[model samples]
Target: MPRTFDGATGPVAGRFAIVVSRYNENVTGKLLQGAIETLTQAGIADDDIDVAWVPGAWEIPLIAQRMAETGHYAAVLNLGAVIRGETTHDEHINRQVSLSLGELSLVTGVPMLFGVLTVNSLEQAIHRSGGNVGNKGMECAEAALQMVRLLAQLPE
Candidate 1:
């Protein structure tokens, strides 16, 4: 992220918090790494980024809500993989977590960046996490940086 804004140029301040799901470690691990790298590149130090891992996708929002409400982070980044299977189980988790994260951002007035992948197959998730589709983790970090900067410009 560019530190210099149009007329309000200033140092990008505040820390970031990440909530990662360990259910799909193969994919989520890569996502987590990418997110960390991106945040660092955006001027956030490693020490400033706090990471919390949860059991699975379903558990992401609860922790994310808690983190967002802490008022200690400029943004909360959530990363996970929710792939479709024979049943509609993935659908339920995806809808609830996605909606809840959205609600958390609105209610807490904090930026909740969703890096979760809701895909039809492992291949698609792979493509997104750090594959040809580009890393959603990096994308989420960039988004969080942008939103944090914008929100900082707003009146309290």
Candidate 2:
């Protein structure tokens, strides 16, 4: 028989950090709200969660890296909204931020969730941030909690 490791759902025990972009306040704000609400509902105290706001999605990785390196947070959630514009700016931002956050998580052994929304329009962004599509922020928070528990079960 083969054994399997599963992330059990329950109240998580640890501190968390949310690095959000201030560029798209309309969408990112809701993301921050969802992440916080999810974390709190899962047993993380208000003070246990710290939020840092950056200028844009480009700055998320730096702040996220800093928070994760502190060894204070079990995971770091990166939230932002990069709506497609006239240029290819959104593409670059999304790729770089995603790569950087993923690499940072590997280097630090701490969960770094990519909750940024790289959507085509404001309507799409709205639909994802606590909208009909569902909140990516809440999803990120849940992933963070699961990662923390999953990692704990792995052998060092």
Candidate 2: stretches off by over 4 Å? none
Which residues of candidate 1, in runs, are more than 4 Å off?
1-10
lDDT of 1 by residue, 1-156 (tens): 756443133457788999999998899999999999988876788999999999999999999989988899999999999999999999999999999999999999989999999999999999999999999999898888888887877667
lDDT, candidates in the order shown? 0.90, 0.93
Judging by lDDT against the true structure, name the best candidate.
Answer: 2
- Candidate 1, residue 88: Cα displacement in angstroms equals 0.6
lDDT of 2 by residue, 1-156 (tens): 777676666456889999999998999999999999999999899999999999999999999999999999999999999999999999999999999998999999889999999999999999999899999999999999998888777778
In terms of lDDT, model 1 sits at 0.90
Give the TM-score of each candidate: 0.92, 0.97
| Decoy 2 TM-score against native | 0.97
Question: Model 1: clashing residue pairs?
Answer: none
